[model samples]
Target: MRLTPRIVPLLLLAAALLGAAPAAPHPVEAQAPQASWSWPLEPRPAVVHPFDPPERPWLSGHRGVDLAASAGATVRAPAPGTVVFVGWVVDRPVVTIDHGDGLRSSFEPVDSPLALGVEVEKETPLGTLEPAEVGHCAPAACLHWGVRRGDEYVDPLQFVEDRRPSVLLPWAGPP
Candidate 1:
């Protein structure tokens, strides 16, 4: 009844108006820069389609995501960055990196032999994955994965992981 600090913000505003649910769960401030990044698709590939961006800027969302991956797999380099671009677009095969300050990612149908400035690091590979009738995850095979900074369109799974938004915490067990 006397925890001080103004009674701890009125007991956190009466536990947010009595909804009360928070035994621990805070961290979630990374737009990019916490463990850098990874997972261009290796032992961890299965999103199928997410990142639905587009509130304006021409509409038709789905900015990026769609992991699955199988046709040719490989496709690495989720961090270090350099290979500015690789090829194709209107029909598939993309690639593109440039992870400097303005961060970029892009990977599409991918087939890259690793040209165009070439630097890469994080995972390296950066090729393969272009079979399933050239992307769009037709019968399966995926790997769209896109991220940008200069033009916007973020949420490449918030850089490798921690998509956040699952805070239940409040049941110490022994009920």
Candidate 2:
């Protein structure tokens, strides 16, 4: 095919689309800006599972982190953004919050009432972690939280620090 003006742009777009495989790589990754992020679970819940990126784009690996959460624990937004999705992705009821700058967070096996495009702030009550008999944590309920920059899977915890009330020390005014 001749490299025409229209064709050139389309070709580049095709390359980018293929590069964004969550497991693949793209040049736009380093350029895409990121928002101020936080943790979806309060008190920095126990990491039942950690993100394990695949060596190859087609290899199998954990795409997200699983945090230890009760059946009905509240799951909040890690950053201020809009709800882009709230539905089933394969077998689990997932809630996805878009933090803009090509960054988004996905939490699955959750119970939420928020609709699409709902504006939420950091630590906003986005949903409640629901117990499931089938998932990464079978027989035990946990929240599967995943962060992504475009199609590239990124570590959610790396951007957040423990800031829960349980971990902070209260101080009285100096006399």
Candidate 3:
């Protein structure tokens, strides 16, 4: 049976709207939890140095992970959240995004254009990376990404996988 021209467009439109076509199903990779968010720097395997014995004798261990990236590289928010703090710490700007579930992501030496109370989306540019100072780091530029839950400082790398566009490296997954 031949279809009328008038009916053809309507059928096509309906199919498009309903997504009824047999298209290749996108791979069903497990979505990292909503609590899990993006990493600030361009995706790369993390280079972590164990916390020295003198650094924290009381705490369990090193509180955060250091991501290797160049200076002035864009830093993005890991998740959709509110900017709770944006200010200078020892003359270097720091921005903090609060995920509202006792989870917070923070960046140091940032040039933040966003102010406190501003809502940020996942992967939104929070600031640019700054040069690491002497004694703080050897000579390379890197982002010292950190996370805090309530009062306890935990490893930020543990919360989210590398969701950067160029690579898909598996992380330990969120805690």
Best-fitting candidate, scored by TM-score: 2
34-67 in candidate 1: lDDT tens per residue? 4458788889887878898889969888888888
Better of 1 and 2 by lDDT: 2
Q: Which segments of candidate 1 are over 4 A away from where they belong?
A: 1-59, 62-69, 82-98, 106-123, 126-136, 154-175
Write out the backbone clash pairs for model 2: 22-151
Residue 121 in candidate 3, Cα distance off native in Å: 0.6
Residue pairs with backbone atoms closer than 3 Å in model 1 (clashes): none
How many clashing pairs per prediction, in order?
0, 1, 0
lDDT of 2: 0.83
The RMSD (Cα, Å) of candidate 1 is 16.1
Lowest lDDT 10-mer window, candidate 3? 48-57
Name the top lDDT candidate: 2
CA RMSD (A), model 3? 16.4
Position 72, candidate 2: lDDT: 88
Alpha-carbon local distance difference test for all models: 0.82, 0.83, 0.73
Residue by residue across 1-175, what tens digits does model 2's lDDT show?
A: 5688979998899999988857633333233334356668777789999889898868998888899988889999988989999998888899999988998899999889999989999989988888777887978999998889999998787667432233333344497
TM-score versus the correct structure, for each prediction:
0.28, 0.70, 0.63
